[model samples]
Target: MKTQKLTLTVVMVAILVVMAYIPAIPLGPVPLTIQNIGVMLAGAILGWRNGLLAIIIWLLMAALGLPVLTGGSGGIAPFFGATAGYIWAYPVAALFIGLSLQALTRFNRVNFVTILLTIIVFGVILIDLSGAVGLHITTNMPLPKALIFQLTFIPGDIVKSIVATILTLTLRQRFTALSHA
Candidate 1:
């Protein structure tokens, strides 16, 4: 079980790294990257604790100057930039999604679609809120403006959430052990 957890954690970190390398859609300070998809999946598949660990690992590597963020940017500097809020929110979002799904799974009353929707909704809310807060703090931007600007990413986030949901569900069905873990 421990081995499985470690393996999955590493896999999630790898996914984040790979996703980070994908070209981002330049939009103001926060470029849209598919990295959030990996974050969502990490929580859904690895559970909250492990998912958070994976994200932490990835962030640490990036902080150490590895090119693990969008557009191959790295170092501790980005964490203090305008988009830092979104970057820091990844693990929290993953943990929220994972915990929500785990709790829902305990009930066994929710269907897969319901579970997926719940995770995505919570994940989006948490991620956006944290990102907005971070942006406001770092840039001295007004909260309302930061939140409004965040709206621009909603459509893309929804799409990523859907993809993460489908992929998580499919993988969960195929790997019952990992899902339960």
Candidate 2:
């Protein structure tokens, strides 16, 4: 069981790396990257703890100067940038998302609505909030302006949440590791 969990975590990390390699649409401070889907799926499919570990591993790699984050940009520099909050929030979002998924699974209520809501709140909304905070701090932007700017993140996040929900539903059925959660 431990081996399976570790293997799944590694696989999820690899998936995240692949997602990051996909070109990102650079829009203002935060670029639009499909990598958020990987973060959401990490928690939704791997369970909370394992998902968090995988995210941390990915972050550590990026911090070590590996081009693992979106846009092939990596280093400790991004951590102090306006997008840092969003980056930092990935593991946190994954933790909560995984927890929500686990609860739903335990109650046999892991449907589209439940999973979508989980991803929307924990994955999308949470990251939005964190990104806004990062903008506020790094750029000294007003909170209201920061929030307004963060509105740009919504459409993509919604799409990512939907994709995550569909992927979670399918993976939970076919993957025993996810099914247990």
Candidate 3:
């Protein structure tokens, strides 16, 4: 079962990485993507360790010259480029989202809706803000421009987060392992 789970996780992450690279819907600085769904799913389904590992694996593939990033751009260069911080933050974001869910489970009587809402809001805003800050520093953009770019991402990110939350809730109800209890 462990081997199967690991294999499934790897395949899912790989598919997500490819989805990340595809640029079908370009929207200024941020392209529409299913990548966040993968990120959220990784956390919600796989929990911290396995979730993070999946992201790392995807990133490693991208680093290894796979076009597993937006607009099919990938390489060591992108890893240090403008979007680097956001890309790097993915694993940590997933970790937090997953672990927070786990913590929520510990309470045993908490509101599921609240927990999911908090994860979406916190994960999207805080984590993406860190990426924007990195973009500001790395690209040397002014704070205002950076904020604009970050805002561009907000709409799409909110959509992704909500979708992720819904999907996570549904999957958790079906799959016992998602709770990791």
Please, what is the TM-score per model?
Answer: 0.91, 0.94, 0.84
Q: Which model scores highest in TM-score?
A: 2
Q: Which residue pairs of candidate 3 clash?
A: 21-69
The per-candidate count of clashes, in order, stands at 0, 0, 1
Tens-place lDDT per residue, model 3, 82-135, is: 666677788887788778777877886325575567556556776677767777
Q: List the residue pairs that clash in candidate 2.
A: none
Q: Enumerate residue pairs that collide in model 1.
A: none
Give all candidates' CA lDDT scores.
0.83, 0.91, 0.72
Stretches of candidate 3 exceeding 4 Å from the true structure:
21-24, 27-32, 109-112, 177-181
Q: What is the Å distance of residue 3 in model 2 from its true position?
A: 2.4
Q: Write the per-residue lDDT of candidate 2 for residues 28-90, one digit (tens) a residue.
A: 877888998999999998999999999999999999999898878799998989788899899
How would you order the candidates by lDDT, starting with the best? 2, 1, 3
RMSD of each: 2.4, 2.2, 3.0
Model 3 lowest lDDT segment of ten: 109-118
Kindly indicate the candidate among 2 and 3 with the higher TM-score: 2
lDDT of candidate 1? 0.83
